[model samples]
Target: MAAMPPMDDELKALQWRAWHRGTREADLMIGGFFDAHREQWGSQERDWFSGLLQEQDVDIMAWAIGAAEPPARFQGPMMQAMQRLDYLKAPK
Candidate 1:
């Protein structure tokens, strides 16, 4: 996909909002992403994910929401993160 316009502080604002609001949507997206890739992540990875700052997860989830575009260098990790987000938000 074409790179999005450089976001400057727009992305950061979104991340901050999600974190302050404690958006369940953000948690679900981040949790689902990690859950879907459970096998790929070793125990340490899982621990790291669990220990991540809520703002960090909010930032990643913000990217998946397309509320912010991730940096081009982060595409691969963002893609993986999105996959997990999709699974978590999928219809039960």
Candidate 2:
């Protein structure tokens, strides 16, 4: 049997969804972003990220890749932070 991942409930839930987003690209973008930043996020940032999780993976990818503009409500520091894509690793 496989060992379970260690995490608190909130973080476990977020990480699960982040890595399981419909596409590998979405997973890398969202999951990598979460891994890079989760340690430093505050309550409001967590809430905002939770809201972002409700969006479709395609839309999220589009926004992150600049293929489409994020909706007005999603346009702000957090979205801008996502747009940076600094968390994505370079291919080896």
Candidate 3:
């Protein structure tokens, strides 16, 4: 397999995507999750999150908030963490 890009560069790209989801709410929910949990992630977690960033923001938000069930691909620990919704800070 080819070498992976430097994680810092990859993570910077992910950060931009997470925080620019076209609406403030999506930005907060997605970006906040990224910020809060990213340090703990390994390759599998990063891959999952990278795939998630490709999903519709409304779908992602719904999954995060428990209003809708995530597809099998998105279920499991990562989604569980997102559902907790504790990472978001109220706007000051």
Please, what are the lDDT tens digits per residue for candidate 3 over residues 1-92? Answer: 56444458889899899999999999999999998888888889999999999999999999998999999999999999999999999878
TM-score for each predicted model, relative to the true structure: 0.45, 0.86, 0.90
What is the alpha-carbon lDDT of model 1 when measured against the actual structure? Answer: 0.52
Candidate 2 or 3, higher lDDT? 3
Index of the highest-TM-score prediction: 3
Work out how many backbone clashes candidate 3 has. Answer: 0
Count the clashes in each prediction. Answer: 1, 0, 0
Lowest lDDT 10-residue stretch of candidate 2: 1-10
Which tens-of-lDDT digit does each residue in 1-92 have in candidate 2? 56444567898898898899878888999999898888777788888888899999999989988999999888998888899999899899
- Scanning candidate 3 in windows of ten residues, the lowest lDDT window is 1-10
For candidate 2, the lDDT comes to 0.87
Model 3 misplacement above 4 A: 1-7
**In candidate 1, which residue pairs get closer than 3 Å at backbone N, Cα or C atoms, i.e. clash?**
33-84
Candidate with best lDDT = 3
Model 1 CA deviation exceeding 4 Å by range = 1-21, 42-58, 77-85, 89-92
- Cα lDDT for residue 83, model 3? 98
